[model samples]
Target: MLDIKFIMENSEIVKAACKNKNEQDNVDKIIDLNRMRKIYTAERDELRRQLNEISAEIGEIAKKGGDISSIKVKAKEISEQVKSVEEELSIVEKELDRLVLTVPNIPDSSVPVGFSEDDNKTIRIIGEPQKFDFVPKNHIQLNEKLHLFELERAAKITGSFFPLFTGKGAKLVRSLVNFMLDIHTADGKYYEIFPPFLVNRDSMLGTAQLPKLEEDMYRVEQEDYFLIPTGEVPMTNLYRGEKLSEDDLPIYYCGYSACFRREAGSYGKDTKGLMRLHQFDKVELVKIVHPDNSYDELEGLLHDAEKILDLLGIHYRVRVLCTGDLTFASAKTYDIEIWAPGTEKWLEVSSVSNLTDFQARRMNTRFRSSKDNKLHYVHTLNGSGVAIPRLIISLLETYQNSDGAIEIPEILQDYFGAEKIE
Candidate 1:
């Protein structure tokens, strides 16, 4: 959540920031609500002072044992007025909070002004697209012919966008998860955490996934917990409400978890395969760092994710996310897209974002300065160190051979215990 003081002091700047991000916010109404809440508070305090004075006078009349009824009645009327003012104050406060939540995080100055993914500029291309002589098959066809997947049973059990992996498909999924984790944890010391599948509402808000993406999530109504949409949700909340010392400036965490999303609004897109799913496996990298170092951490995190596609020998590209394409918590974001030759498109495999104090403020997660002992909000960041299923899709499509074999990348050959998956 944004600080009200910041909003009050920088209303115009905030409105301009929202305009650049192509997001709509009722800035005028937000300011008006703040004004109303402040006015209500002042009046309520004044009324309470009057009520206290009247009660004191009533007490004196009672002590004197003469004509206390009039004083008592006056005190009672003041109490009712105070109650009415208090109720109005409560309404104004709620409206102010709702308005504040509607205002999104401002884009960093470096963020380019754009309204859609089409306008995103490529920062650089990591590796060349794979050269293939034969016609490459998509993951769906390859998985089916090789007896690697069973969607029929998956549909019966759940519904569309769910696939059951068997034989090679299961191994492929496991291998992908293991491979991604190993790379992210190599020397970087990303503490691996296997988080719970379900988390409370506060967990969702910490990562800026709630309030807006609430509809896309699966909530257990009675328990008031929601199935995690991604490892990002639980991983970031690990340090929720925590205060770290300066020496703990950076906390790197990598979590493996099963993510569930309703795909609630997406009706017909990527329904045939793992491009989008109700449930998928992922490894996410989350960091809590000093504000000055967060942008650099963003690059490091992106490279950590890019290293996977590079190691897999899969062709991919990295794009600096335009402001409009950024997540609610991110000040700046970079998405890693892998080339899926069969589909003739780039599949986004990960998004590395730098959220400077936006999440920390909401979570009340802070860090104390080593030099001055001053507490400050830490900048938070997270990325799919890589998601399993989509990367699998890219790998299968890029490595497919004319003989219906899929050559495993050299780095993962030993992990999967064979050079080729056929």
Candidate 2:
């Protein structure tokens, strides 16, 4: 949440940011509401002071054996006035709180000014898309010959976009999860967390996903719990409503979870193979760090995620998301897109983001600074160490031989208990 004080002091700047984000939140309405709140507060305070004075006067009159009825009448009038102002103030404050939550995070100065993914700037291509001696088959064609996955069975069991893997396909999923988890927990120095897949409404709101993207979530209506869309949602909220000391300036956590999404508006895009799915696996990375080092940590997070692709020897590129492409709570984001040889396209596998206190404010997660002994919101960051299905798609398509066997990357061969899948 953008601080109300900051918005109040700089309404125009806030409005411009809203414009840039193509959001329609009314800055003027918020400002007017705040002004009304201030007026009502002042009126209430003045009336309270008058009520106290009337009490004092009445007490003095009673002690001196003077008529106190007039003072009592005045006290009654003042008390009623104060109650009226309190009621108005409460209404205005509630409205103000509601509007504030609608405001999007202000974009960082470094973010490119643009309106869509097409405008995003490419950072660099890490590895070249391999040239094939024979025609490269897409994941669907390759999977048909290999019999590694069954989409028809999955569809019959759980509707479309649900994946059911068999043989090495199932083992591939397990191996990837373990391999990614090990990288982040071991060399990345991140503590691993196996968080609950279900979360409450407040937990969803804390991650800035509730009010905005309700339709995209799966909710257990009876229990009011939401199946998490990403491990970031639950992992980031671990320190919610808590305060950490300065000694713990930087805290890192990596979580692996089965994510569920409704994908409500997506009708006909990437429906053929593993492009988009209703349920998927992901290894998520989250960091809570001091404001001074958040961007640095963001870079570190990008490199950490990139290492997985490097070890797996997947060809990929990095893209800096333009302002319009940034997620609801991210101040800045970098997406890592891996090349899929069969599809001849780049599939986004991870999005490393620096939320820059936007989420911390919502979660009420703070840290006390030793230098000033003042409490400040810690910067929050999260990324997919990598999402699974697309990576699986890339792996099958990229490493498949002319004979239809998949040569497992050297890093994962031991985990798969074989060098190749035939």
TM-score of 1: 0.91
RMSD of 2: 2.5
| Model 1: per-residue Cα lDDT over 62-108, one tens digit each | 78887887667777888898899889989888887777777788888
Name the top TM-score candidate: 2
Error of 1 at 320 (Å): 0.9
Best candidate, lDDT-wise?
2
Look at candidate 2 and tell me the lDDT of residue 53: 85
Native-to-model Cα distance after best TM-score fit, residue 278 in candidate 1, in Å: 1.3
User: Runs in model 1 with CA error above 4 Å?
Assistant: 46-81
What would the per-residue lDDT of candidate 2 be over residues 265-374, giving only the tens digit for each residue? 99797777889999999999999999999999999999999999999999999999988888778889999999999998899999999999999999999999988999
Candidate lDDT (C-alpha), each: 0.85, 0.92
